[model samples]
Target: MIALVTAALAPGIALLSYFYLRNEYESRTFTQVLRAFIIGALLVFPIMVLQYALEAESIFEAEWLHAFVGVAGLEEFFKWFLLYFAIYRFVLFQSRYDGIIYGVALSLGFASAENVMYLMALGIDSAIGRAFLPVSSHALFGVVMGYYMGCAKKSDPNNFKLWISLSLVVPIILHGVYDLILLTIHENVMFIIVPFMFFLWWFALSRTKKANEKMA
Candidate 1:
């Protein structure tokens, strides 16, 4: 059981640490990051309940709708809400890269919990795949979300709306497409997913670099 828990959480912890420690300009205290993580972890339960309710009601009959609206929409919306309301105006959020740090923390928090539950049901053999795919994907999605959020924080009133909207919309779209690909492609899913993952990594790293450069 202990091993199982460790296996489930290790990937998320590693990713979270990578993003958190990469900030050179201003550092956020552990408490601030942990608070966001805990809040994000707590979000999984409500989101699960809501998803279950949606499923029970047959609210979304089509697979595409379920993937885009039911799953991606709900998950990203709550994460965005928390980032915008709970962490946006934080005292330590003075630096542009801080958004990436908090975003990664919250995302990995949720992803870690979700990964644990998934591994418990599917067993340990699935851990590697989950780590590479779902967990990493969540972190990348957070990068995209956080990048725009950081922009919104530093933007003028005229541009604030655009950045903030992209913060939510971009993640939803990327997450939705990710789910759609997995749901629709049964055989050789990795063929498509691999390239997609590569794109995510490149895009996320570029965003990270841009945010860090802006800090200078």
Candidate 2:
């Protein structure tokens, strides 16, 4: 059980540390980041309940709808909402890169909790694949979300809406597409999933670089 818990949480903790350390300008307090992470981790239960309700009601009959709207939509929407309401207004959220840090904190929190619950139910043999896939993907998605949100924080009123919209919409799309690919593709799943993950890494890193550059 200890091993399972460790395996489940290690990826998210490692990823969160990596992104948190990337802040070059201002550093956020550990409390603030941990708060965001806890908030994110707590989101899992509500989302699961919602997803289960939708499934029970047969609200989404199609796989695409399930992936895009049912899964990604609910997950990203809640994260975006919390990030906006919970951490966005913090005075400590001073740097553009801070958005990335908090975003990662929130995302990995959710991912870590979800991973643990999943492994607990399914067993630890799948832990390695999950660390590389779902856990890492959540971190990347957070980067994209946080990058635009950081922009939104600093943008003029005219562009604030645009950045904020991208902050939510873009992550939903990326997450939706990711789920869609997994749901639709059965044979040789890695062939497509691997490239998509590569794209996510490239896009996320570029966003990270740009955010850092803006800070500099």
For lDDT, the strongest prediction is: 2
Cα RMSD to native, each candidate?
1.3, 1.2
Task: State how far residue 159 of model 1 sits from its true place (Å).
Answer: 0.8
Q: What lDDT does model 1 reach?
A: 0.90
lDDT, model 1, position 18: 89
What would the C-alpha RMSD of candidate 1 be, to one decimal place? 1.3
* TM match of model 2 to true structure: 0.97
* lDDT digits (tens) for residues 49-83 of candidate 1: 99999999999889999999999999999999999
Kindly report which residue pairs in candidate 1 clash with one another: none
Worst window of 10 by summed lDDT in candidate 1: 89-98
* Global lDDT scores for all candidate models: 0.90, 0.92
Write one digit per residue (lDDT tens) for candidate 2, span 34-105. Answer: 998999999999999999999999999899999999999999999999999888976455767888888899
After TM-score superposition, the amount by which residue 23's alpha carbon in candidate 1 deviates from its true location, in angstroms, is 1.5
Off by over 4 Å in 1: none
